[model samples]
Target: MAHKRFAQIPMSKRMRELCKEEDFAFLKSQPDQDQSSEESKLQESQTQKKLERDHRQEERQLNEQERQREIEEQKKVQCHAEKEEKWKSHVAELAVKREAIHAKLHRLREFRDFQKKVLLQDLDPGSTNETINHLLMRL
Candidate 1:
C-alpha cells in the first residue's frame, strides 16, 4: 500500500496571502509603534461601556415597573376589601334601623288598642275616677 502525503500551509502565511488577495490594505497598514488608532480605541471602549450602562438602566427600569404593578394590585385588593367592609357595616346599620322601626310600630299598635278599649267602655262622670283606677291597675 502506498501512503499519500499532503502539504500543509502555515496559518500566518495563509492569512497573509488571503489579505493580499483581498486587497485588505487596512490590516497591513502600520500604526505608530503604540498599535491601534487612539480615536478608534476610545470610541470602541466608550461604545461598549455605554452599551453595558444602558442595559443596566433598562433592567432597573423594568424592575421598577414590575414593583409598581405589584403595588397597584395590592392597592386594588385593599380598596376592594375596604368597600366590602363598608357594605357590611351599612347592611348591619340598616338592620338595626329596621328593628327600631318595627319596635315603634308595635308600640303604636298597643296605643291604638288601648284607645279602642277606652272608646268602647261607657262610664258615667260619677264613675270616672273608678275607671281611671281600673285602667291604671291594668297598665
Candidate 2:
C-alpha cells in the first residue's frame, strides 16, 4: 500500500527529491575512482608476485642447505669408511707381524731345546727346564 502511494508520485518529482550535490560529485569522480581501483589492483598483484618470488627464493635456499648437509654427511661417511679401511689394513698387517714373530719364537725355542739336549753336556745335570739356560760346553 505504501509502495502504491509512493509510485503514484511523478517521476520528475522523484528525480528532484533524489538528486543531491554529493551524488553528482560522486558520479563526476567515478573515473578517478576506477583509476584508483585499477592502481590498487596492480599494486596488490605486484606485491603478490614479490611474495611468491620470495617464497621460491626461500625454498631454493632451504634446498641448497639440505643439499649441503647431505654432501657433508656423505663426506663424513666416506671419510669414516676410509678410516675404517685403513684400520682394517693396519690390523691385518699387525696380525701378520704377530704370526711371523710367533713362528720365529717357536723356531728359536726348538733350536734352544735341541742345543740343550745335544750340544750342552752336563752343565747343571740336576737343573730343571726353564726360560734361562746355560751350557758348560759348546759343539
Candidate 3:
C-alpha cells in the first residue's frame, strides 16, 4: 500500500514538471524562430531582385548586339550597291569606246575600197588617163 502511494505521487509530479519544461522550451524558441524566418524571407527577396536585374541587363545587351549587327549589314549592302554602280558606269564607258572603234573600222574599209578602185583604173591597158578620170567621176 505504501509503495503504491509513492508511485502515484512521483508519477504526477514528474508529469507536471515535464509539462512546465516543454512550455518553457517553446517560449524560449519562439522569438529566435521568428527572427530566422524574417531573415530568410529578406534573403529570398534580395535574390529575386538580383535575378531581375541580371535578366534586364542580358536583354539590353542582346538588343545592343542586334542593333550593331543591323548597322553592319546595312553598311555592307551600301558598299555592294556602290560597287555595282561603279561596274555599270565602267561598262557604259566601254560600250562607247567600242562604238567609236566600229565606226573607225567602217571608214577605213571605205578608204581601202577607194584606193583599190583607183589602182585598177590606172592598170587597164586600153583606158586613157582622161577616160579613167571620166570613169572615176561617174563612179
Candidate 4:
C-alpha cells in the first residue's frame, strides 16, 4: 500500500461493509472482479460528490427565489401605503374645496334674499315718486 502517494484516497464505504477475509480471497483469485470493484468504488465516490454539488446549487437557487419574493412583497406593501396616504390627502383637499363652494353659495343666497326684499318694497302701492322712478328705470 503506497499510502504516502495516495494520502487523499478514502476507504470505500461499500468495501468496508464487506470485511470478511473470504470476500477479499475470492476477489483476489479473480483479477477481473478485483478491477471492477476498484472502478465501482471510484465511480461511487464521484457520484457522491456530484450529488453534494447539486444539492448545494439547488439550495442557493431556492434562497435567491425566496429573497426576490420578499423584495416584491415589500415593494407591494410600500406602494399600497403610499396610495392610501395619497387618497387620504386628496379627500382632505376635496373636503376643503367643498366647504369653500358651500360658503360661496350661502353668500349668494343671502344677496339674492336682500335683492328680493328691496324689489318687494319698491312694488308696494303705497310707495310714492321714488318707486315710480325705480319702475321706469327697470323698463
Candidate with maximal lDDT:
3
Deviating ranges (above 4 Å) for candidate 3? 1-42, 120-139
**What are the lDDT scores of the predictions, listed in order?**
0.75, 0.76, 0.80, 0.78
Candidate 4 residue-wise lDDT, 1-139, digit = tens: 2336545767675544455455668767665644677787887899999999999999999999999999999999999999999999999999999999999999988976676567667676677666655764684
Clashes of 2: 0
lDDT of 1 by residue, 1-139 (tens): 1112312534476665665656546644534465668866886799999999999999999999999999999999999999999999999999999999999999988986786467447655456655665665686
Q: Residue 44 deviation, candidate 4, in Å?
A: 4.5
Scanning candidate 2 in windows of ten residues, the lowest lDDT window is 130-139
- Against the true structure, what is every candidate's RMSD? 11.0, 13.1, 16.1, 13.1
Give the lDDT ranking, best first.
3, 4, 2, 1
Evaluate residue 121 in candidate 3 and report its C-alpha lDDT on the 0 to 100 scale: 61
TM-scores, all candidates, are 0.54, 0.61, 0.54, 0.53
Instruction: Locate the minimum summed-lDDT window of 10 residues in model 3.
Output: 1-10
| Candidate 2 Cα misplacement greater than 4 A, ranges | 1-36, 120-132, 136-139
Alpha-carbon deviation at 33 in model 4, angstroms: 4.9
- Model 1 bad stretches (over 4 Å): 1-47, 123-139
Write out the backbone clash pairs for model 1: none
Inter-residue clash pairs, candidate 2: none
The local distance difference test score of model 1 is 0.75
